[model samples]
Target: EWAKAFNPFFAGENADWLAMIPFGILALILYYVGRELLLSGKKTRA
Candidate 1:
């Protein structure tokens, strides 16, 4: 019941890859930004 209410990928008869693309891009961008920030902090500390 909860799965049916919240799961977008499996909500309809087809999988929603289009809806998931922006989220994937955002995640990758966030990961790279976080990594760069962490590295810059370590360099400044050293």
Candidate 2:
């Protein structure tokens, strides 16, 4: 399937599930920070 083709582990013989933990955490932190900044900007403009 297309999903497997794009997966980082699909092309490799080994899958590093543990390596994804940090990246996942970073992604969540970035999402929250970006959301907060966007909301703050809107409040100031209003």
What lDDT score is found at residue 1 in candidate 1?
77
lDDT by residue (1-46, candidate 1, tens digit) is: 7766777665765557857888999898888788795344545544
Q: What is the lDDT of residue 11 in candidate 2?
A: 53
lDDT of 2 by residue, 1-46 (tens): 8746776665544457745778999888888788795344545544
Clashing pairs in 2: none
**Overall lDDT per candidate, in order of appearance:** 0.72, 0.68
TM-score for each prediction? 0.46, 0.46
Lowest summed lDDT across 10 adjacent residues in model 2 is found at 37-46
